[model samples]
Target: MKPRFYDLSMPLSEKTAPFPLDTPFSRVETMRMEDGDACNVTVITMSVHVGTHVDAPYHYDEQGLRIDEVALERYIGKANVFTVYPREVDGIPIITADDVRELSISAERVLLHTETYPEYAAFHANFASIEPDAIDVLAERGVRLIGVDVPSVDKATSKTLPAHKRCREREILILENLRLEHVPDGDYELIALPLRIAGGDASPVRAVLRMYAETKDMT
Candidate 1:
């Protein structure tokens, strides 16, 4: 039987919601067949974090690796999906350490399905965020990479970014803005390699997941 797959990345376009104060996606046609050009050509402008993207340690640490410098192996591997329905406080939901420890995740990379930021058309300040201790719990369980359905692991209004700092300290990679609402909880092989942008803090990635049966024999 043919294998099943799921695309976890959000679609990138002019309407995609970007982190506040970051660049929004825009395109300008530089040349087109109708304009007598040989072929269609356009220029795009947007933040690296505009869509589903991976963050290198450079995103928060001054001496950390850049997007191009981070190993590709970190993005492609067995990944477990853990879902924790939100329980909000002050209009924001937080995933605590206990929330992650209670799950029987057995992968080095894991994606959190919080059902926050359900749509890509708008940015909401009340989306779910993870606590720093939760990062520690994931690290204790041998997680090397973390993915979230929300825009950032920290709250939208966060300035200190404790969660990001903890990830930086733990040397864990981060993939954010994933579209995982329709994906069920389970183990799968992830293939979400980021762009090799030199000196970049982050890069947009096309996150994909293959069924466990398709990758069980793979190394």
Candidate 2:
């Protein structure tokens, strides 16, 4: 049987919610067929971290690798999807290390479906964020990349961004704002390659997952 693919990326548009104070997606038509132009042409402007995207290590560390410098292999490989419910401590939703420890992390890439930031046009400040200890646990489990269903790995009000820093320290890449609501929890082949932006701290990605079957041995 042919393998099936699931799109795990959020649609980028003017209505797509961006990180607080970050640039939202916008398009300006340079040429239009309706306006007596030969063809339609547009200029897009948005933050690299907008919508579904990957955060290169340089996003946090000054000496870290840029988006173009990161290996493509890190973004494409076997990945495990784990659904984690939100738990609040002191009125803040967080994905604790204990939550990560309960997961069967058999792959180098892990996508956590928190269902916190479910609406693309609405920004939720209380979206679940992965704790720094959770990052440590994932790193110890040989996880090379972490993907989430929220705009960021750290809390919205976090200034220091401990989770992001820990990921950088562990050399783990990050994919944020993934659309995992329709994707069931299981193993899949992930292909979420970031754009090769020179000296970019981060880059948008068109993330997708291919259904993995054990009989076919699709990795």
Candidate 3:
């Protein structure tokens, strides 16, 4: 059967909330059609990690691949959405190795949908994050892509940045600040395309998911 599709990416804008350390998102007017120009055009500039985005291996590894080096298939495929939120309200929860194991996700791509959704559109300093051990589990499971609904895989104030390192070492792609309130845990086709930024550590993404059913073995 044809599956239903849902966009799981956060909207980008100068007004959107951003990380404390990074500069606030900014888009100044370079050209305005209101000035009697031929067309209405505006120059845009912002941090690569500003809105819904992906983290390349280069984000943490010195010899990792850059945003432009990422392949199309890496961000688009059948993925499993796992919800490990342990809070009553949608908040960042610590994901452990056991949690990864319980999800039974052996696919190349995995999307983590935290409980923060449906009405959560603002950024929070503390949100769900994966433990370093959880990163190991994903690497061991041969997961090539990992996504979440927060700004960074590491805590907002992480000292070691272990989560980013582990994923980078394993060549796992990281998609962050996703809008997964409209989605649930299940098997789905994920189409998350990142900007082709040359030698960039990360880039914004336009992510979408298509729902599907698993058929019995034909072999």
Candidate 4:
């Protein structure tokens, strides 16, 4: 059976929103063919965490592995996709441990589709975030990697980053700012690899998902 593929990466450009105080995505035409240059060359500048990106263990754990040191196998494998709309808890939209426990995950990688922060043009401060307990629940369920549609697993205003710390302690990978609104919940093969940036904390990825289905006879 052939499989259907879904792109889970955001389009990076000047319009892509950056994290609060982080560098925005930008591109400059260094050599435009229209300007009589030999070829069209463009230069881009942005934070590694700007678009759909994977965080290395070093992102939170000072003694953890860097982006180049992580095994590529972790970024490519079977993954479970689930959707969760956070509920208001103490005036904040949060995915709790109870919420994570409700998901019937059968894969090492789990992607959550929360409709919050649905666009790349602007930054939203109140996007749904995951709690530390939720991270713990995912870890206990044998989830090695976790993906979220929102920009972060922790609150936008959080300084301590409890959720991120918890994931670090659990040795779970994190993929943030994924484009998951169009993707449905199911088990799929996920391929989201980060660049081998030496000593980098995070790197944007061209994330994709493949779902198996019955083949149709064109007779």
- Model 2 over residues 185-212: C-alpha lDDT tens digits? 9998899999989999999999999876
Q: How many residue pairs in model 3 have overlapping backbones? A: 3
Once fitted onto the true fold, the runs of candidate 4 whose alpha carbons sit more than 4 angstroms away are 1-3, 212-219
RMSD, one per candidate, in order = 1.3, 1.8, 3.7, 3.5
Clashes of 2: 0
Which residue pairs clash in candidate 1?
A: none
Q: Number of the top candidate by lDDT?
A: 2
Give the RMSD in angstroms, all C-alphas superposed, for model 4: 3.5
How high is the CA lDDT of each candidate model?
A: 0.91, 0.92, 0.77, 0.89
Better of 1 and 2 by lDDT: 2
Scored by Cα lDDT, where does model 1 land?
Answer: 0.91
Q: What's model 2's overall lDDT?
A: 0.92
TM-score of 3: 0.87
- Candidate 2, clashing residue pairs? none
lDDT of 1 by residue, 1-219 (tens): 443899998988988989999999999999999989999999999999999999989899899999999989999989999899766777679998888889897999999999878988898888899999989999999999999999999999999999999998888889999999878899999999988899999999999999987779977
> Which portions of model 3 miss their true places by more than 4 Å?
1-3, 86-92, 116-122, 213-219
What ranking of all candidate models by TM-score puts the best one first? 1, 2, 4, 3
Candidate 2 stretches greater than 4 Å from native: 1-3, 214-219
Alpha-carbon deviation at 201 in model 3, angstroms:
1.1
Per-residue lDDT of candidate 4, residues 1-219 (tens digit): 343789999999888999989999989999999999999999999999999999888888889899999999999888999988789977779998999899998989999998988777899888888989999989989999999998999999999989888989998999999998788788888899999899999999999997733212212
Structural similarity to truth (TM-score) of each candidate: 0.97, 0.96, 0.87, 0.94
